[model samples]
Target: MSEPEAKRIKMADGTKAPVIGTHNGHFHADEALAVYLLRLLPQYANSSLIRTRDAEVLKTCDIVCDVGGVHDHDAKRYDHHQREFNAVFPGSATKLSSAGLVWMHYGKDIIASVTGLATSDANNDLLYNKLYADFIEAFDANDNGIPIYDPAALRSAGIEKRFSDKGFSMAGVVNRFNYAATEPRNAAKASVSADAPAAPKQKTQEEEDTRFQKASHFVGEQFVAELLDKAGSWLPAREVVKQAFADRAQYDAQGRIIVIPWKPEGVPWMEHLYNLEEENGAKGAVLYALFAESGEPDSKWRIRAVSLEPGSFENRKGLPEAWRGVRDEELSKVSGIPGAIFVHASGFIGGNASFDGALQMAKQSVDM
Candidate 1:
């Protein structure tokens, strides 16, 4: 929509729709995602958006973001560009961007709106933190220009990237919407001015605003997709992990092995496992987990090592070294267990054709 046309949009009841204000020139992923996130609320679902840097105009706006040089949560100002600003998400070192700022204040409400959970629910708080850490923080880190790793540390460790993946991130995708003059608007006129310098072409205010809308929707789609997956798939898996953890003694008398009776793809178990372990005062107690490889009856069962920490690559304990990379009848002969499939070369995981075989592998590995 044109800038003039969007100056004010009235609600259905003839009341003035609340206005969201931001900078006008070019937009970035932080502000784009910020605006989209705000619109997810009931009050702002039909709110009008005004992209401008004018302080007076922003003063009249119900909410201002990424342009107003203020970070007052009570006043609904969420800009992060002020020289003195150093606000980060609670308990996190990464600095806030407009996206993270918006999320910090209104994330629970947004989660409720999308997932129909009570705003005060414990699960809502879980998702609020989970979504930020897994998804929203990247936008904050990118907009603030924070590298994932300290460059000096990476260099000191002699870790060099084998190839470049420039312009391949979600931030890069959003940046593609920024206005660029692919070719001069009037090439012939510029050619005629051989001796004089030609002024660079620029997108009109309306064109720039439209691109901003496109960019917002682009990031917003991804944000919603991630939120839904967390709420729908990831949240439910917490219960399964909790149950399996509680039933650990059924598989191992010493409670060293937990069993997931059923197998579903992409089940997130480690974080919940660690939390449960700490809560029950059994931290670092679970060494192995056994579960069916698939829902199919004849499918193999897997015996896997538990990680030392949630999301860590290192494990607390690995399968026997003798079983590593051994497969089929040879694996069965080496372990003296029937229906053996193979063990991972790293010994983090192994598979067998039946639940009893997989269970025996875990029991033997624990002794080793």
Candidate 2:
């Protein structure tokens, strides 16, 4: 018999769907935030640090819907001094944790993410019990607990794509890109290079390799620009995209810019992937962890279920079957996003399947 169909859950949206087990199926940041915050929504209305705006936040959400995250004081404003929580819990020291989260909300979907402090190197870098217990206790605190949270200064994390609302793509080095267009806020300044003639070209293998390396670097920079533009703080769009690829810092430093496709490194696949050990020529679990460009933790994220829209598959014959459900089994189970908001991501998987050769083998398995 076909595998038991996904259990559908009823929602106010009028679409009856199966309720995905938060345990069996990973609930990243958005889903985590939604579940956690929804449970706490009834309390935000009475918080002291929360102004009328914070209270409005509770009223605006789906009561039982996803608001992205609690750490996202920038997106869904929270009551900072609510007695228990970090007061500045969502923002404050979370620094890169917040920026990383911003990138996820825009470029990714299928899963969501949330940031947490990992005090123990054990428990595989994900102590769910530790994180959950900490959040709930702090969130429920009453007096000296909330030491510093300013309502006027905070919004949920996934609100904007940047530190500020207005944002733009950035590229420090580019040729095709025009820099002369935007008026430089500062006076014109130019640097001079030594007046030496460039060396003549030789078709040496090393030279060819250097040229290829430069090209790859340029491409990577361009991708970063797109990531910032689409997922910047200004976008205020939920969802996150991350990259998971060969750890070769020399080649792919950003990992793989994947939509939610797999687990973070330490959970299970870290041993094989991190060590690059192909024991007996057998591949290890495919671990894909794409991060936000900003410093914050990834919020909403998921692994894109690559598939054709029914009959559309016949017309788009060239579309790889692997692109749809290729090697997603491992990933589908645990997309790293924690809270509720959702977005789609792809480049991350494409990178890994290309480098690690897992996706390619998976495709072959399906075709056979």
Q: Pick the candidate with the highest TM-score.
A: 1
Cα lDDT computed for each candidate against the true fold = 0.88, 0.28
lDDT of 1 by residue, 1-368 (tens): 42333457877788878888899986799999999999999989987788887787788788888988899999999999999999988878999999999999999999999999998999999999999999999999999999999999999999999877657788887778885544455655456556676675668887788888989999999999999998988888888898998889988888999987674655778787888899899989999988887788887899989987877778899999999999999999999999999999998899999999999999999999
Residue 350, model 1: Cα distance from true site in angstroms? 1.5
For candidate 1, the TM-score is: 0.89
Q: Where does model 2 exceed 4 Å of error? A: 1-121, 124-129, 132-134, 143-148, 151-368
TM-score of each: 0.89, 0.16
- Candidate 1, lDDT over the whole model: 0.88
Cα-lDDT of candidate 2: 0.28
Q: Write the per-residue lDDT of candidate 2 for residues 1-368, one digit (tens) a residue.
A: 00122323344576543211111111122222223222222222121110012333344332222222343434442222222333222332431222122222221211112222232323212222223222322322211223236544566543433463212211112221221222242432333234643344343433332332343244334433433433332122211111222332322233222222333321222222322324323232232333222223433232222222322322211223324333344433333212212222332222232222333322322233
**How well does candidate 2 score on lDDT at residue 180?**
23
Q: Each candidate's root-mean-square deviation in Å?
A: 3.8, 26.2
Give me the candidate number with maximum lDDT. 1
